[model samples]
Target: MQPKKNSIIKTLKLSKKKILVFIFFVAALVASFLFVLKDIPESATIGANNYPQSTKIYDRNGKMLYTFYTTKNQTFVSLDKISENLKKATIAIEDRDFYKHGAIDLRGITRAFIYTVFKKQVQGGSTITQQLVKNSLLTPERTITRKIKEIILAFVVEGVYSKDKILEMYLNQVSYGGTAWGVEAASYVYFDKPVERLNLAESAFLAALPEAPSIYSPFGSRPELGKKRQLEVLRRMEEQKYITKDQRREAGEFQLKFSKIQNKISAPHFVFYVKALLVQKYGARAVEQGGLNVTTSLDLDLQNYAQASVAAEISTLERMNVTNGAALIAKPGTGEILAMVGSKDYFDEENDGNVNVVLAKRQPGSSIKPINYAVGLIKGFTAATPFVDEKTCFPNPGRAPYCPLNYDGKFHGVVQMRFALANSFNIPAVKMLKANGLEAMMATASAMGIKTFEDL
Candidate 1:
């Protein structure tokens, strides 16, 4: 009886081994299918206007003044191009286990998952590659679907690319602060140094900037919060043995050589051109994610001139009880907006941002008359097309009588379409719209880029 019981136990143990082996094979096959080793896809493409690189603002002679970009707005470079300190600082802060992982670091993922699942708090355990992917390709909006995709892609990128290649791509594509992509851009914009010249303290500081860009970017409008974050980075660096105790002490006390935000575009209206391009090309997702690189037709020289002219007008308006003003410049034929100055300065001081004004609709006043004239033009009403320019009482066919007046508060007699529109005579527009029989004029305006109708 004892020998028979022992035999039954041995049979059961052998059966369990076979079942476990089968299960392992099934999981391996599924994982293999999910992350096929060949033909990796480019994560997300950062496109520019007409140009392959981001929309670069050039001078009349073709010098780059401002560049619109999604991430770093530059090429993904090789690791050999970067400094050892930057590599160390990034690996120390981002992913200490990058050399060993398949796109997904299961241990880190497990740790983060367990903590969040049990503690119910926001935490980030993503590798540097994951962060770079999120910065360049994915939105920050938290979702399970995005996480799964990120892990799969990370594993695939890791298998295909070398460690240095991944780090180089990460450094170049990551965001440092508001519209500042890549560590090199941040270096030029902030400390006025190149990425290669960044000291350990500065490199650590830049690494810290991504955790909460708007709040911790020392170069941005806010410095107090940035200082606090710098200290936190120092502490973490020490805890991770990235720096010695003495190194941490020295870095903690180190004064970051930061600078104020450069107000490049004096033109408020040109901000609208970029915003419109972002909305048109990348959609609302890219705009909100700050991953859009816009290459525009704007000439910095022309934009600066326009911004100065418009600002002067705003100053004059303030004296007349008008505190706000806006302006725009568009390329001919294509109608691509070259420059848009949104506000005198709308950058947020609190969270470090501002709303764009050029896209915002203000009362066009006489400016709207141009659209109506455009309508008349489309209806074969050339500049020579004659129309009555009388302010004579306007009444609906069977409705209340109304009257429209020109800015001069006087009526122009009969005039040609060219003279009426070029002179911006308001009464002619009202009469023209009335004569075009309302419905046809409405259709014409809709076809000619007039968005919504409020006062129409």
Candidate 2:
């Protein structure tokens, strides 16, 4: 009977120890909760000043022609500008209970922790707000202190910003793939268009990029993995009721047409020239990060055609030892540069394709004859007037005698001004220049937009 009593007393002692341990656990949890709550701000503000955004270069029709950036290629667009499908897809895949969660998804964190610790399966428990806090304000280093701060900051951010605003900030701040940051730039880099125009399938495809940008990039070696991720996103969207069964099936089966990788700008020379002009006008920093939306008078279609034409002509001219060529098309009336082909191929390093031959100085050959004869006409020389075209030598003051001959090697004894100018007769052109006077001819050429003879 005494032994039985002693056993009961031992049982009571064990119960008391368990109760104390429970109270200690509860106290510790409350203290941690208070610590996190105290650090959270009442309000939060997100601004573009936090990072550098690429200055977008667009054609007159609002088509994205090129982007100028240092490292990260991003163009921020409002949440309203993004496609509804993309928003739904992102939420469905990244965080289903994003709207219902407070600052942190406790359930998701618990599950992820269990999976990471016991199951050895890595999973992210971060909600979109937490991700935004970590990506923008904090460093990428994974630590207990950083994570705690992220959770606290995310809670503060949600309280300050509306759900729509928070989602908008997340969409704009997240990296899509490669160097693409935000939906707008990703849309252009992937679909070659605006983010608002993306379809359901495209949206799903893009939503999957944030998981592992390089690993799921269509341009990368593992394109199939990207496709699989996209399908998973669609499945999640369907499960969330954001998309119907048929819609998910159709999106899953949709053939994705990716935009060709534009490693260089469409019109490299023209774009660079525009960049230089912008830099001159708005300093380097402003041009790079001031988010200047530049609309130039370039006709992209005509420019492409002109580039193709130049490339074709270069191929044909290659046999004649012409390694490269350049072409420029401009309106005679308005002087609007319609197209500027700097070289045959901008990537052709062997031929120095980057050099703008249109700006290069070379002998004008017979091209200058028109200007000289036009000056002669201004000096009262009529087209019907005759001039002797012969292999004649004119006495020079200091230099050797200036001899001029016909290109055909046979001189026509007499030629009319029209025939001389039209046929580009060198001897007649020299005489016309002499008649007009050097200073007057130079002034006439200058007035006609011949910049090469400025010193002369």
Candidate 3:
């Protein structure tokens, strides 16, 4: 009787403890719900233009170079104006379950949480609605509190707006690299066409950019990566049944011709160089949207003259297979850039004219002969030092012997260093390099501001 009575009391005590735990859980849940509810923003104000003002760039003479803006470049279009292909492509790549899920994807969030905690990889599980809310209403902070607020606002926004409205706003508010702020702007920027005219391939290409504008920009460094990303978007679209397999194959094989940048700016490469510096100093957000009035040291008159000279020279050299040229004029005393022409023409995309060749790494060819001669002179080799410019091979222990030949494929025997340098003889230069020692030449070049050479 006593043992049975003790068992009954133990069961009653366990029931009381379970009830208290349930009550505490419920109380905490109610408190958290109320706390987050107060932070939710008004969903009706989502369409309001809250973007910052444009930053103006000017030359030293106060002439406007460019008006750098993210929002200023935006051209908002109705959802119907945008291409259906682009819409499908965006949905396929960005969020496959956009239509099926609510404001937050619980399953995706759970998976991301598992990856973050167990695999030690932080990942985002934001739905389209959540993204719209975060980009429009919240700061770009990666914090638990901020994420909680983003989730709350996403729910409120979904409740107030339909899915179509949310998608429309998102397409308008998202950035698509450079000064492009919306799909309409991106369409024109990349294809030189309206958003409605983007075909399946073009639409897929643009759809790939919003994931990372700088990385996936066709005009950016490593453009092959952008092509790879476009193919990935097409793959996703096919997997989700948004695009057929044939359409995916065709789109993947399509050659995309990007439009030349058409922003109204003077000395575009110089302007961009200055903008890059500014972005480095101030954050990208501040430089693009902080309304900064930047005055550079560029002389517009010299810039125009240099551009004309380069164009004329390149035209003259066209028959010689020279398709491009660059020029940089600076004040010799102060080293301030008076004019900088990065290429022969900034608008010639076919010839890769947008590439700033002045900054590119290339074999100096005969141009580096002067540096070689200078290093030889420093190492006690006089101008009259005689080098045999005959057929000779420098020995290598494990590789083929480095045999150098002159540009004209004829050698002049026993030439002075000055004459060999003047004529730019390859054999004499190689012989001089061998005598001067590679380490000694590299040290001299480094001191003379030749930065491209790596440690041997």
Candidate 4:
């Protein structure tokens, strides 16, 4: 009886031990669930905004002249809206288990650890959700706290939204470089079309670019480097069976085309100017966060006309080996900028695109004679005032005797203010400045918007 009783007690103890283990496991799982529930906030439900307010520039005609942005707008489209090849290529390139994973992929994490551990290096196992979390809510600076926050937020996002919604958020919020914030913007910049129109080869090419945008842009900037990276994306797509071997070959050798934003008709200089102003107003962060629609004092029709005039002048000066011209036209009465043609092309850096030539100090030649006439007007010299033009000298500043002559070296003796201005005769004007003091002529120049003088 004692031996049988001992056997029964042992069986009961084994059953109790199994029950205790199961209870602990269930408690741990429940505790984890409760903890996750506590950490998730309502704000984590929708996609978090990471981009700053971008500044826009418009012409008088209400056309968009330029856009200055730190990070550009991301055009978000539905999975159903985008091409099938695009969806496949992006999945193949980024995360294959994007749909199955709940914000984080445990299997991927384990596999990555196993592979990289043996090789003695760290490899990223971040899912698209984790990446999105990092991009949206957290600072890009790598740190333990940031990582923790990212994980928490990603989990919250998974709980709140559907897989397709998450994918849309990721696609729309991703940075594709060159002032382009999303895949759609990148597509338009690279292919002059929208995401829905992206072909298989094009889709693969775009998916490949995100790894290193500066290096792998399809613009043939670093063709060898770009081609290599693009090829890698294509090969990965094939390996993942997103595309077949035939598709991969076709993609690998496809002819790529790129458009130049630098050569746009929009005023690039003015765009930069507005961007600088936005940076001043909202700080650098505003360039991404502000999303400002800047209404500038620029007039498009007047700008075009002014540019045409400068172009005409440049053509005339071609024989003199001059290839540059600039103009700044202000509203006749209000001094508002009617037009400003910085240069011939939007990105003509030599012009720095905005010389604001009206504000530039140039060799006055005979143009400054009018300022002296204005000075004479201020000094009680009437509009019908008269002055004698002769060889005269002011004995000061160690200057030479003034024998002011016209461009043809012809000397006109006696001239009235109207003749002096209309003909631009210099002797009478110099005499007037000499008589009225230098400040008087400078004041007159200031009144007329001539701020600097390179002529004596």
Please name the candidate that would achieve the greatest TM-score relative to the true structure.
2
TM-score of each: 0.49, 0.81, 0.50, 0.60
lDDT of 1 by residue, 1-456 (tens): 999999999999999999999999999988765654233346534211121223433444444455455543433334565656667767766676778776767887787788799989545689877776676656677876677666667766666667777777778777787666677667656775557887877877887777788888665577778777666677767777778889887877878777567724333345445556667976754554443344456667776676678668877877678655556788889886666666554453442224456666667677767777777777777888877777577766777787777777876787898888888887778887776777776677678777665765
lDDT of model 1 at position 279: 71
Stretch of 10 with least lDDT, candidate 3:
47-56
lDDT of 2 at 173: 79
lDDT of 4 by residue, 185-262 (tens): 677677767688888778887777766777877554666787776787789888987778998999889887766755
Residue 343 C-alpha lDDT in model 1: 59
What RMSD value applies to candidate 4?
Answer: 7.7
Question: What is the alpha-carbon lDDT for the whole of candidate 4?
Answer: 0.71
Task: List ranges where model 1 is wrong by over 4 Å.
Answer: 1-76, 83-189, 192-257, 261-292, 348-357, 362-364, 377-382, 387-391, 397-400
Winner on lDDT between 1 and 4 is 4
TM-score for candidate 3: 0.50
Go through the candidates in order and give each one's C-alpha lDDT. Answer: 0.66, 0.85, 0.86, 0.71
Off by more than 4 A, model 3: 1-27, 49-72, 107-124, 265-456
Q: What's the best-to-worst order under lDDT?
A: 3, 2, 4, 1
Cand. 4 TM to true fold = 0.60
